[model samples]
Target: MYILIRYAALSGKRTATLFPDTPVAVACSLLFKFVLNVFYGTIVVENEHYIPKNGEPVIVCSNHVNSLTDALLLVTSVSSKKRNFLRLTAKDSQFGRKTFSSWLIENAGTLPIQRRKEHGDQADNSTTMDKLLTALSEGDAICLFPEGMSRFHPTMAPLKTGVARIVSDVLTRNRDNPEFAVTLLTCSLTYVHRWSFRSDVLVSFNPPLKLTVKDTPSLISTPDKPVDFEAIKSLTTFMHAQLSSNTIDSPSWDLVRVAKTAARIYVPLGTRMRLGDWVRVVARFVEGLAKPVEGTGAGTGGEGVAIERQGMKRTAYQDQLNALGLKDDRIRQSITLSRIKILWRLFLRICQTCLFLAIAAPGLFLWVPVFATTTYKSEQLKRSGPVWDTHDEVAQTKLVYGLASGIFVWLTAIILTTPIFGLGLFFTIWFVPAWMWLTLRWTEDLIAAFRAAVALYRLLWVSKADLKRLRETREDLHGRVMNVATEVLGLPKDPEAEFLVVEGEEGDDQPSRWAKHQRGRTRGGWDSALRYFSIRRRRKRDWNETLRWFDATEFPKE
Candidate 1:
């Protein structure tokens, strides 16, 4: 009887008893993992230990940003050994389409919830609730997107009450089992460039929130009784707060980019900034700037002041780059050297690129079709999807389509190579993917080196006096912004302390040593200059450190 129900689910028909196919789930997970690795350059998982080792009953709640990638990242990151049974709750429309997607979702153990009305009447959600409760009761790890839908917004959308309601039902049903423990774990996905291929992603898992029948007495509803509306609302609010704290929120990507650039300049030379810390600082700064000021005759004074200060700093930074005939990319490339040194660096880079091209040439021929198809599909999806208002949405659309198209490309490559290579089919099948991965990483480094070389060439046109003046103005602007940020964030008003720079332990002679040390680090021309400013022997509290205080206060944990 159970097998029949499982077969029905796989056939795209609603079934009362849905059983997960472990082998299908594992295969789907591997496919998603392959696509993610090909799409993203780096996938950094923070506090992964927070994911409960002893499965018990768990529901993973995460903010929905990237369309399907959010669910893919969460599901694929967890080891199958750790949690053998994993299921997801998706909208009913996704399952009722009678398309390939429906088949995929059904086989992956996804439970569909009706999100719309039937002919102007409310559709019954009792079945969906019952299915969710049954899954939890069986100790399956359920992944849910409480936001209900994906958006390109910098901050998370208001969470729906479904997650809270589901939890409430599970707790009520398990009232008799005192030993049963259900854990709610919050995960955050931060994309450095959400829609772009070969971009970086930060996945953070916050400590789980343990709940029992005793923990939410007010939220519990009997099997036949309706859930308490107020209790569900309260729980939703709590979940939103917890989810928001772990994730980075910004009003716009422009502001985030500005803040990140400013932070690099604002921090003392010889110190490195963690990406998470940079995100927190930007969030805090933006939040602080948005807050209303006290004792202002006009309501816009605080906002106006922040805007003016931020504009002035941004302008100053841009002007300095312009004077040197450079842009943000070149500045970040950290190419500060004499003409003779730059020429030497350019020669070395050319040699390195030649070496890489020679090695990558064979794989390029095999993977070009895959790359071209994915890129074309991604562009078409971006232009056609509902993303005209924001570039972020366009990126998300491209990523969704790109990943879907990639699976076809991979399969095609395998099919084409298998018949041609015959006995060597296994090696041929894996070659293109491995080649594509290397190409993605190599191309990025190569471009950076090329940009640094161009910046170096352009530096020859600038006079020393002009460069010095620009540097002075840049520092002055940075100081002003720091002062304003400090005042707005309620930090100690020590202007001198903000500009304090700690020299390296070996003093002025350290540059040569650092240069020597960095020579062995990477082949990129920017390494020496970036390392010179970013390498520190010890961590110390500075203006950048003060930003954390605001982050903690502004986005307090629930």
Candidate 2:
């Protein structure tokens, strides 16, 4: 399945390269996407017209919310014929052509990235930065998921330093060239029925912006204050600004709709399902196969009745298999959130372990002490109040006292002249065990930070699983509704859309979904329920909901 996607991307690249400008490439992407949707279903491109028609060395930075398909989605959103090819930044794991990821090599000329320790795993066997910098210098337009990897979240996640780094490098290198002002544009993808028909997924584009180094606070700093911390702040703001202007008001499911539309209406895969004004509604025929075959009066009371839901348009040709199928294979259930999160978890675990072990190795252990303590202290010295600020004359006195004691240790160790005294003499020879102290502190901080990260990831994992189950219930409910849509009151032929409005309206009127979420989380088989009720009777809402999130799907899916 993944191979087919890579195949389409590669073919699209070859097809798009024939044309000039980025638009053709986008067009080719669209065509290729259109092609893939034949079997994949439709991917509706919403607000895509917002993508800029022209720009200098532009970047289409979108929230990397899904799979590699985001790359092609960008291409097609603009045009299929433009040739200003786009190169994507991919992790180093996809480094070589070793069968499984071989197609990745063929399709996306994905620039392999191996991180340089910036606080993850001090693991840098390969310099992905050099490669990324090299690519920037190559003058090709590219896109990066500043978050580093596709993440699961209701809204756009936090910006990472990478985007800032890329912008800084380009601006710094091309300081004098007007053309060097790299245009960074944000593309906010709002998925509708992400994998089904009539998706209202939107790909809104914001005006391109520039990241200039001249905007920094004094590329240099004053005594005691040693870093250009504000510069990072400015760059971070730019990332938010890049997409802020383009984001539209919508919920999670909206994006699914858009993605599904684009997915289906897209071009064919291989050469088997090309488009020309019409598609084999054979794909469209299954539009609601889940419905009864004939007013509940056919085989098995009409349950055996088959339907094929592809785009309603009939194509020039139909595959015999599709024709013979008991159902319309065009539209399909979207890849569930559970599945996507599972994959994300797998990817994250692998990557995190690689990061952890690499950073934890002996080579790093040698410096861990330095990074942990001394460096952190140095930084603290820069940020904290002056040592004398406590006006605690006591601190200065301690400093003096400790200094005198150090000198006394040297004198005493010298006088003792024993091997143990020699060791004391050696330590006292230097200042405050300073050499080993920094790295030790740094290691502790690193461990704490990783602990926080692991904690955060655990929390996220629980949330991911819980959310998936909740969504499954909702989707299952949706499935049930569809199976009985025509039969239900207040429902449409496609009631999911209607359910959306109901959900939205309820969202507005509810007394804080968070509150409801907490109550919902209590596990129960009557006893647990009784316990929850007892606890609820004594606790007020404020303190209760703050720490408890047992609602929305119970205990989270850890």
Candidate 3:
């Protein structure tokens, strides 16, 4: 029944603004993602808005990360205007028929393949290659992570030759037209606080690189042969320049990691409004130019009032899309109020879920000690990059702090109830659920924080004075949360540790999970990012200000 609603909402006509395969996929993904990005531990930030507007068939390649969460980020990065023709290549380990992950894959229109029993030698590379070629030939931009498996590595390990072959095959298939070049859009996603609430992800979008007929075929690696070292080397080098080129001159290891180690993160967009407002106005103009004319013809005996009602709806919708920054009438017909109705339901469902959890948090607080040993993973994820890469001490400290917070909560409860009686019954009924609910409640808060942050930044120029006050309020709120954290942990807050660098040091450098080919390499530029993005200039100023407040970078003296 639910599936029927989703399919009902999906547009099937060839003339629909969205591609036939895309609408349901887009709605489901975005609906699921709105929850995941908020409640689950994922953050989507600094999206590149330009590449999607340039709209053409292309391949998005990146290093593999755990879970299908990457797909959600990719979906949100795209503008709704150009989502019809995108698809993904997913492997079978997680995408088999009965699995939850597989359901998502199928629903998202992913093409799945079975991988080798052994890690490497016997893998059938041919079927995978064929699937991608077919998808691309159909004008669908294919998205795949070149590194097939997800494992912890400091650098991008040898890429399966499959991706290179796909590019080679596509260019070979379309050798005649210069415009038919296979475009490779490299995206670099770096986490400022990986997996944490309100974490920041910087997505660096490089200009698309075209591997044309003139480029040598020798760069394609062969499966049966020793993986072509030169070809793999060149590919990584090119990507390193595209993805990590900004790393070249940075002084601190942190900046360098942010710039290079994440060189191969992938981005796939369903619809991208990354176009500048002026460009959007221009694209809207172009779309208006291309939008189809819709003239309603009456059925021979239908009621005139019924037809009049439909006409009013059409008129109202035309006005709404124009207000949402869409200029084309084609877009108006595509996003019916029925589509927005689903979005409203998704929004309401998420709100109800958090509300229910907020009512249950107190009960969960009482069971913390039990969940602590069982939850064994509260701090283990810190080992991965962008934060506690080498911070075992920090990880251990987090566990201890968590335990301490439990103790503080108990003690506070005891103090509050001394005159009345034992607090356990009250707590078992109250704060346990409160704690449980807060985690989910915090999810909404964090997501709202991010959304509010983006919306506020979007209007910074027009609302400069209000924006200044808001940032001050944000800092004050952060300070209150920190205080609450300290009190819950029963720790006497130290004024000194406020400024200490507890996360990383020079001696603890571990290999970045994305760098390929050991020899040090680098590239440079922001002229393109600047010219295309007004936000880039504003972001640069904010980045510089952020650096000053977090002044750990020991810039070299001139």
* Total clashes for model 1: 1
TM-score comparison, 1 vs 3, better candidate? 1
lDDT tens digits, residue span 318-366, model 2: 2221222211111222233354564575466556545645544534533
Question: Candidate 1's C-alpha lDDT?
Answer: 0.57
Predictions in order: lDDT: 0.57, 0.38, 0.40
- Rank by lDDT, highest first: 1, 3, 2
Q: Model 3, 421-507: lDDT tens per residue?
A: 565566554664345445444433434333323322233232435434444533443343233223322222442232111222211
Once fitted onto the true fold, the runs of candidate 3 whose alpha carbons sit more than 4 angstroms away are 1-27, 39-49, 52-55, 114-120, 153-161, 176-179, 214-233, 246-558
Maximum-TM-score candidate:
1
Which should have the higher lDDT, number 1 or number 3? Answer: 1
TM per candidate comes to 0.74, 0.37, 0.43
